[model samples]
Target: MSFTDSTEAPIYAGLVEEQGDVPAEVRRVAEEVLREADRAIDFGTVGAASAR
Candidate 1:
């Protein structure tokens, strides 16, 4: 999934920047995690109903 707004990139970038110099692989994984979190938040914010 992708971000719906441009504002998210900078916030995510700031999160990455705060980590200092992390290993390339670790950084990649962290970014993937952040993206997933952003997707989940967006889905929740838009009020998508859930069966559970």
Candidate 2:
């Protein structure tokens, strides 16, 4: 599920339309989410390598 597909996307879109940008906290949280996703992928790769 993506942010756009999520129920929150509509609310976020409305805020962007009205405010001209996402809130700073929202942007920061998004960055953190992406970083955590990256780390999860990296960890999976490392685990696979170790298993092999």
Candidate 3:
């Protein structure tokens, strides 16, 4: 799922909006990280691990 559709998106949006001075690069990196995290959560491990 896209970052905007993730659960954290609203909170992140609120924080970012409150911090109006956030730099463009920082915003870009933060959004990228969020998107990656969202993707990971959406496509996480599908089964229990075998005994190690």
Reference-based TM-score of each model: 0.37, 0.37, 0.37
- Per-residue CA lDDT of model 1 for 1-52, tens digit only, reads 3232337676655655676435666879999999999977776645655643
Candidate 2 regions with alpha-carbon error over 4 angstroms: 1-22, 42-52
Q: Mark the regions of model 1 whose C-alpha exceeds 4 Å error after superposition.
A: 1-22, 43-52
Q: Flag the better candidate by lDDT, 1 or 2.
A: 2
CA error at residue 4 for candidate 1, angstroms: 36
Q: Once model 2 is optimally superposed onto the true structure by TM-score, how far is the C-alpha of residue 4 displaced, in angstroms?
A: 27
lDDT by residue for model 3 (1-52), tens: 6344337688656666677536766889999999999887854454434322
Q: Which ten-residue region of model 3 has the weakest summed lDDT?
A: 43-52
User: Clashing residue pairs in candidate 3, if any?
Assistant: none
* Residues 1-48, model 2: lDDT tens digits: 644433769976666667766566688999999999997777667878
lDDT of each: 0.65, 0.73, 0.66
When summed lDDT is taken over every stretch of 10 residues in candidate 1, the lowest stretch is 1-10
